[model samples]
Target: MIRLKAFPILAAALVASLALTACGKDAAPAGPKLALDAPLPETIPAGTKLVIGDPTTQRVVELNGWDKDLPFQIEWAQISGGPAVTEAFHAKALDVGSAANIPPIHAIWVGIPVKMIAVRLRKDHVNFPLFELGIAPKAGIKSLADLRGKKIAYSPGQVQGEVVLRTLAAVGLTQKDVTLVELPSTGDVYPNALVSGLVDVAPLGAGVATKRYLDNYARDGAQVLRHPPYRDDLTNLYVRAETLHDPAKAAALRAYVKLWARAVEWQATHKAEWRDAYYVRQEGLSPEDAEFVVRAAGDPVIPRDWTEAIGMQQSSIDFLAKEGGQKRFDAAEIFDRRFEALAAEAAPKIAVGPAPAQTEGKTNP
Candidate 1:
């Protein structure tokens, strides 16, 4: 979250950046940075189709009416995680992809024309992490140092992967110190991988990590190696550069952004309905465990400030790129603000639910 104190300065800087005019009087028109209203073509061409790549178990937009009453039809693709979605973007398979902060950062570094259209902040990121580094009981790993020469499962181009990297770097270890086991970025697989001893340690998914932690505790005992709170890098809604150029598609995206934010607002505010429908029914997760996952997810926010998010991502890129042997690039260029107007327009209207601050990281059954 953008600290309330920093809003004034960030807002002014963003306005000033947006006000820049083209390459200058002598150069070709630069075009508007983003169109909040008028002059943005509003019609969806007949039979226009949009493919949305979902990152995990629930896509809240589909749960609510956001995917309904659309000017165009939406084709949903269950893309598992950020790294996988980056590959999908390369193939031009995703019009809108939901991913963590790492995907676009790595994509932009590799020259994939992608940009974040919307961002959702987890308020609980300030209190508890949505991810954890889990180790098997037999591994006998008591601390970060013990991780050396151990096999750690991770999916590159994902948030928890970055966390693992950061954890290694902090302890003066490099990728060479341990065997890095690369896995598909799916929430379903991490727990089993660890239990079966396929990998000594792994970063488990948000709900899976918590559920497995409880399950293993009762059955054979599992240990959470680490869970970092206040790691504010977030899940993002992104689009391919090609989609941003089509006038009809762009307009539809604007509406989609607003409706998606509305969906987030509804989901965050109505925990029971969301958990029951999404977690218990659809996902087959137990209710008590579902409640923990919901609270841990925090509130979904269509952030008003891009400055904070961009800075956090840039820092991560710098750290990972140097260590992972990737070329350096600017992070500010990775976000598309064309939908900001509609995003802000939909934010304040979500009046039904408790605010992000009220929950304090626990959910009621």
Candidate 2:
């Protein structure tokens, strides 16, 4: 499985694959080796379509144009959010998708056969925490415990929805203790939901804390509730198992991960460009708002392996099954790790013992 922490997982895909062979897709005779550091084959075999569902447009624009230069032809699909992306996967309309940690966990429970390919960690760690649950100032809710009997937004299979359950569990409560208002998993929807009083509290990404995004809400009436920091839920990348079985698709997926890291590093270094292209130009956000997002996006890091992410997911699954009433499933069975070699080749930092402190671009995703 792919994970990140103190130790950089440099080269362990073979070993991880060995473990995967005991069960699941990789158990058959090994597929062709995916080249992580080298250029891909000159062309994709005739008439093969690699459909990619990119919720965020950033991936296709990496390195200014790396994706456009890939060896294979990409049939890019414009998808909305995680839930829609999951639906695309189930319908076989999508071969690859990216989302928060919760989406895949829910997919597995529902018997969708997708696998987590790679994970992106926050560069600053979580001192401020990019993700949080927020409340309206007049909602009269001061903390997590106050959520009991209140109506809150829930994005069924996404990160925030699961976090809502975990937050309830942390207080020795459950979903029945509060009313859950189901909503799609998205960052933009949360603030509007909170401001309109559609829901008392909403899951938000840390970027909402920036002046540009949250200024009106904060100045008028919105306030984020204080609570213990939620555990690290990495921005996850997922691909279909059928794609993994195809050597060409696996190679393309590997290249995509490597290029993604490059793009994240590029975004980190070229803050002005990121704001210009993504924020101001694409989003039509004000200059000030764009600046706030750029600063808050912080740096991005991709861990070489799933050493830390798996346990985080297990806890998520257990929480959902026991508290959220979702069926249980093993974390290992859902992981496809052929891309570890590519990510490990990038050589991301590995924290040895303890988690350091820090905290996002905007509202929770």
Candidate 3:
């Protein structure tokens, strides 16, 4: 995990530069520095490789036959989430990774300069929100107003922390009004925390996690309440600054970003195949859980313009800074816009419905 005080400033940057220098020494000769608006390199030199940490898109590319014809090579790393990706970037072990919006911002704070190169969101983001509040059994919390004095799980390093903050903001409650049980929301931590009464509330994901929490604990008065409508489904691909300094690697990243966008569209259109291949077969989720998970994802929408996205990020940065007493920076500095149009241009346009139709009777809580 990317612990708040663990990574030091200068050492982190020095290690990242050293790692890139070592990698460059063993690869094809380095090319000239890539300018901000310079055209992308026409041809990637031989031996250009990217260490990709996106497990979902890695599976999508393989299943859809999208990896067989790539000009550059990819080393897929089974890593996701902010903490893992941030740690890898600190060690210079990963070139690019997939995560929510917070990781890139947190990366900047931890002295590892990074940029979000690609972005994705749900077509109907509010209805298809990624997180919901899970109330503990016997907690007697029925609404946001009831949370004034409850213990809530908060992980400032991940997206869940931001959800909790945003949730409180929706109901006009601040952290001072509630007890924030500092915890990590990894794997089954949040669900387990809720069930064990370690916290009265935590943000349970809208898919299998929420489904199983209700199935196992609703009998004991456990309840799941939908958080206020907000845009929380921000998925992004981010890279370390040192990696982008390499022109050859940057060109390779440009190609991967295009494919990454196309992969999102493919996954949205081929939901059944994706659910079976990724959730069921790879992640060991039951068919029902996999189906609910896929439906909850709604449709993928990669925007051609990132102006709105950057605005959202800037708001988040401002909010987090005030809450954590940390210095704030312009959110636009964290995005590399050269690849902004690649995803939208490469993805095939698909008609989007109102929202993912909820599962009929099995579970919608």
- Runs of candidate 1 with Cα error greater than 4 angstroms are 1-40, 55-62, 216-218, 228-232, 349-365
lDDT of 2 by residue, 127-161 (tens): 64556777865688866768888888887667777
Give candidate 2's error at residue 83 in angstroms. Answer: 0.5
Which ranges in model 3 have alpha carbons more than 4 Å from their true place? 1-29, 350-365
Q: For every model shown, what is its TM-score relative to the native structure?
A: 0.79, 0.77, 0.86
Model 2: how far residue 140 lies from native, Å: 1.5
In candidate 1, what are the lDDT values of residues 159-262, reduced to their tens digit?
Answer: 76787787787788888888877775464566677777888888766555666565865356567756443373477788876566666667777767776777
Task: Summarize candidate 3's per-residue lDDT along 40-127 as a digit string, tens digits.
Answer: 5647888878888898788889887888889998888766777777777777778888988888888887788888888887888878
Poorest 10 consecutive residues by lDDT, candidate 2? 356-365
Which residue runs of candidate 2 sit more than 4 Å off their true CA positions?
Answer: 1-47, 55-63, 208-213, 346-365
Where is model 1 poorest over a 10-residue stretch in terms of lDDT? 1-10
In the order shown, the candidates' Cα RMSDs to the true structure are 11.6, 10.6, 8.1
Count: clashes, candidate 3: 0
Model 3, residue 137: C-alpha shift (Å): 1.7
In candidate 3, where is summed lDDT lowest over 10 consecutive residues?
Answer: 356-365
